[model samples]
Target: MDSFDAIVVGSGFGGSVTAYRLAEAGLRVCLLERGKAYPPGSFPRSPHETAKNFWDPSSQLFGMYDLWSFSKLDALVSSGLGGGSLIYANVLIRKPETWFVNESIDGGYERWPVTREDLDPHYDSVERMLDAQPYPFDQKPYEDTPKTVAMQEAAGKLGLSWELPKLAITFARPNEAPAPGVEIPGGDDNLHHSPRSTCRLVGECDLGCNFGSKNSLDLTYLSAAQRRGADIRTFCEVRAFEPVDGGFQVSYIEHRPGQDGDPAAPPLRGAVRARRLILSAGALGTPYLLLRNRSAFPALSPALGSRFSGNGDFLGMIVKARRLQEEGGDGELVPRLLAPSYGPVVTSAMFMPDAHDEGGTGRGFYIEDAGYPEFLNWLVENNVLTMSHRVGRFLLRRAWSAATHSPKSQVGRSAADALSKGLFTATSLPMLGMGRDVPDGRVFLREGHLDLDWDLTASKPYFDRLNKTMGEVSKSLGGRYWASPLWLLNRLITVHPLGGAPMGRDRREGVVDSYGQVYGYPGLSIADGSVMPGPVGPNPSLTIAALADRSAERIIDDHRRNPAGRP
Candidate 1:
């Protein structure tokens, strides 16, 4: 059996950062992932190819961003070596300072044990590694689609703070060809050999960066950690952990592909030994893993599954002009408009903290632009239009067939085709609102599977506030408020789920301590979204990385002080 100084599970922001830091400190680290390593060219970009993209149902159950079909809520997430980063819009954002934790708020829980001050340095470190930078260009040509630029203009009028978003995309330089694979220190052998390429701005990042410009964990930290001598094994799903004499017995399964590379194969089980265990399986996966290992830690805090919250996220579509000529535009392609599908999913954000003051009906939510891949157009045409009584079922069926069968060649032929075309020409923008959600959700183990019992009724105030702000921005941009009625009918969707297994002074109030160490276990630790004690009020990726870095440093310091295990 192979053993290491540390074993990090999941290769997302948290796991990757922890692995890199530990490996840099001369600790032998094994990073285990339940999915295959997605190379630059391996991603499917075309609409037809994207439909076939599916995550393992079993593994998806444990992922933060897994596509979930529950009796309660509709959720979507990804599973792979890079985890959700493989499919997420690379928006690197910092949580607002006020979002740390405030007990003054009604129904608020205890304050976050580790404040902004304790995480500043780690945030700085993560930003540098990911090459976080602001949008390069100031002016966009799309006038009909007023996304970030329009939001900023509206926020300025409202006397609110709006800023260009920090992105993780690498654009091409003049006279430079796309670099697909380039070597970087501490990168994986494949990624190190893979060249770095420029982004084509094909607006297909959400599907996967086939162009290789988006710096996801697989291309950044995970790759770097591999180069630093950390052993990363993919398609290895961890089942549970058992406490051993001086370490832990880690059990996992090897996944195989079915015919034509479909996800239809029996899993082969195996086990390994590790001295130190780091759980970075994300909020959903980590909790699931712990539930599976419940027998090992029966005395864990009852708070292990409490205080769960999603960074209240909402999506709305805004279209300024129905056609290029509708909004006083020249030529077939609209100019002076910022299309939501042009660049990173989120390139700018507007903060509205005061929107919730004075017993306001709303809460803090930032309105940014959301970019969708071409595949979503099909979904919009089939699902969104079919709901309209005007479109007959006979016509809708034909449209669905045409949209799905001939996606690439027959691109501009469906109901959504015209809108998508206009969008491509910068006539539309998808507005996104993210805020702190009420932490009324509960995480628990049922039949050894992680379960989430979340309700949005308590989040009515926050959503109301978000809608008001969004409406204001829409009117200012001379655009109409557009969104999937599904959101209104079934609440909203969230990509950043946080606050489970939070940190506190004792197990009575939290699962882990300020440093992310399990209260009863000496070497066991958590360095992921599971430890985020409260709503981050922003994209949780960067914050999760920062927290992991800080936790790893503390763990290393403690390990150095007491080489032998001590509680």
Candidate 2:
């Protein structure tokens, strides 16, 4: 069996940061990522490439997108070296300090064991490491981004505070001016060892930034860890773990990459021992692994699989926004010229304060301008062709009648009008919302498979308020609004799944303490979204990393204080 000082499962924000911190402290660390590494320009774009971009070990398909379905919700998470950071929209907002509420709930009181003050320093460390920056909407070329302008207009008309949230993307090199669509000069140092470039504004952040513009874990934390001599093995999935003498034992499966012109490969079993083991395989993965190996840690908290939440995540769209004619010649409404697929996945956001603040409502949530790839825009444009054809027929008749009635013809104007009739897609935008929702959901092992028992009914009031705000924003933009397609069918879709082995003051309330140390198990810890005791009220990535930073400090201190074990 292979041995190490520490082992980190999953290479997302938590795992990557922990590995880097531990290795930087001179401890031998091994990071086992279940998915393969994705270098710049390697993400799938073509139909054939996209078809194979799913995670299914049984079918020997190891790809980025990992899709999961449950009775109440559907989830889409990334399965790559950088974990969800590879596919997530790079928003790095911090959790609101006042939004950390302590309230009674179904299972127990939903409270945050660690306060925002405690995480402030750690948050700063993560922000500096990520080199976070706001979208350069104030600069030329970017200043006229249609979707961002539309969202700003909507927020302005509603008298709301709209701001561009900092993003983990590389728009320019250090000390250089902001320039888009240029090669990032220092691109050779990343873990993937691929050339990278600045943002091309292709609206592909969520599908994985192929240009390496996004400052994902693979480029930031994991790269630094690798340079610090940490061992990072991709395509190795940890199956189970158990505490043992002076350390812990981890069993995993190594998946081999296919050779040239062939895609068939076999999985090989492996095991390793570590003085410390940190489970950071994301919210869903960590809890599932713990539940599967529950018998090994018999004294774990009962709240291991409790407090699961979608982070109050909700999606909606504003379609067919009304726009004025070109050159402002006439007052008649025309199809909006704004293109939702022209910027990063999200450019700007509006925050809705909670009741704690004056003149605010229930729980707070953020509504951001969501975008998609140009391919989706092309698909949307294709769907409007039939509508355009019908309008073309109508315009042809009008032109024919005018020509027959008058010596001079207005057919040119009529033809131009026909061509501009169908623009529903170019005028539309998607809004993503996530805030403090009831963390009442739970996860469990059923028939040796992971199952979620999450119901959105408990958070109906929060959802209703969030939806109303979204509708108001859409209405202000002169467009029709509707919930995400799955919402109507009573199903929620979330990319930011959080909580499971939540942090608490003691074992009675959570599986881990404020430092993310498992209460009863000394060397066992969890450093991921699974440690969030409640919803982060924003994009949880930054907060997850901050918490992991604190956890790593605690782990290093514990190691120095008691090198043998924590008996």
lDDT of 2 by residue, 101-181 (tens): 676545533788778899999999999999899999888778999989988988888888899999998887768777878
Q: For candidate 1, give the lDDT.
A: 0.71
Report the C-alpha displacement of residue 319, candidate 1, in angstroms. Answer: 2.8
Q: Give all candidate RMSDs, comma-separated.
A: 6.8, 3.9
Q: lDDT of each structure?
A: 0.71, 0.87
| Candidate 2 wrong stretches, greater than 4 Å | 105-109, 260-263, 324-330, 383-422, 564-567
Question: Across residues 1-567, which tens digit of lDDT does each residue of candidate 1 receive?
Answer: 788888898888889899999988878889888877777777766655555567654543222235644434555656787777888778888876656665632375446777778888888998888778776554333222345556667788777788876777765343443232333333334453555465555567777776567888888787778878999998788988977877787899887756555555677887877778999888777887887788898888888877777777777766653334454557463344655555556667777773334433346767776776645654554455544543454367667778888544543344453233333335557777777767767778777556788776887777777776677776666567776576667656666777678777788888899888888887788988888766777778888899899989987897677666421
TM-score list, all predictions: 0.83, 0.92
* Candidate 2 residue-wise lDDT at 548: 95
**Model 2 error, position 362 (Å):** 0.9
User: Candidate 1, after superposition: displacement of residue 317 in Å?
Assistant: 1.6
